[model samples]
Target: MEALDFAAESLDAIWSEGAIYNIGFERGVSEWRRFIKPDGILAVSELTWLTERRPADLDTHWREHYVEVDTASAKLALLERQGYAPLGYFVLPRRCWLDGYYRPLQQRFAAFLQAHGNSPAAEAIVEERRHEIELYERYGQYFGYGFYIARKCHYG
Candidate 1:
């Protein structure tokens, strides 16, 4: 994989859309800040845990991605240091499990095959569905995903 200079390109893209605000949730909040104007709005969907637990298979993916998965507290602390403030946080851990994500997609793909018949496109869809199931089964050991919201503090 090649790394593009995302920040440089983002800074260079000049366009007007009236009070532009950058919004991204999950995983790359640190990098997303670089693309926004210092005084511009930063709004994001965020996830927080009112409670914590030892997630299953954390070590495998953690080593693979080299991500220091921060708790909600640590994420807020890091945002504060960067002059961003937490705006809102909520925990809506799906009461269901990975089957919730997987089963629907599987059903959709099967329906697609029935509708489309055995074309190459249909076969590709089947393959993709199989891959998704394998990936979710392997990696989605944890039963929930969290959401978060934050804003860039106005310093002026």
Candidate 2:
């Protein structure tokens, strides 16, 4: 995938997995326009700030690493300008079962972090995982990652 020069031409569709939060919705939409076919779709899962009110304890680690994001309305507007419109939006809340999903390798991840603690990259990994766990355990709400299915519009 690294060898492909996608920007040189448009793609049939762009699946933006776990990227909207990383790049923020605006940039992600712009990037999709640059590489996606005019009639294609852009699908993404992202943490949306639906309201302007900021959470008092926004995860520090996440904020530092991922740019602070905006509401779905703001994102919709941005996407519209890029010739795309939202088709659907949905959310999947965190549950105790999710912990089971990670339990198998939780210890392994911890051990890896311990062994690589002194490195910058390791620190980032540790901080992110720790904050996710904390949010799930204490607030019963991990990241509210949202999915937006958008399709490029045609203009005469």
Candidate 3:
């Protein structure tokens, strides 16, 4: 994989939406912190457990797929530990996923299945996506995307 290059302390702001989970949350924040100037900003949207108690199935699904999922308060604590001050956070509305992402993706998946004659491998991938969407639909009250805003601290 090709590496990304960014000068240390060069960025005024770094924004990651939905993709940070791929590298793991804390690791992503820690790695990107070095690229942001002191007093700069970092904004990230992460999958978060909204309720104190989540259903076992929901918990298991995320534990298997996104082991780093946690609460908003936990993320705020993490920000402070990483030398950033928590600014604010908001839960992204359900439409943001259903309309903005999964709906369009479902359409694309349908087209792919049609064009590819619904091969087993491709159908399995589509089914997995469908299952994820269903989980969000059913358990949306327990979890959601949280948009976190923080500023890098200047320790002068």
Best by lDDT: 3
TM-score for each prediction? 0.46, 0.71, 0.94
Over 1-156, each residue of candidate 2 has an lDDT whose tens digit, in order, gives 223367633687878766555556676677657677667888887766544554467655456656645556766777788789779777645543255534544666767877886588987776777666665456444345667788887668
lDDT of 3 at 74: 94
lDDT of 1 by residue, 114-143 (tens): 888878989887896686466446545432
For model 3, the local distance difference test gives: 0.91
Q: Candidate 1: which pairs clash?
A: 45-148, 46-147, 46-148, 46-149, 47-146, 47-147, 47-148
Model 1, which residues run further than 4 Å from truth?
1-27, 34-41, 45-68, 95-100, 108-143
Clashes counted in candidate 2 amount to 0
Model 3 poorest ten-residue lDDT run: 1-10
TM-score of 3: 0.94
Tens-digit lDDT track of model 3 for 1-156: 024499999999999899889887899888898889999999999999998799999999998999889999999999999999999999999999899998999889979998889999889989999999999999999999999999999886
> CA lDDT, every prediction?
0.50, 0.65, 0.91
Q: Give the per-residue Cα lDDT of candidate 1 at 150.
A: 58
Models sorted by lDDT, best on top: 3, 2, 1
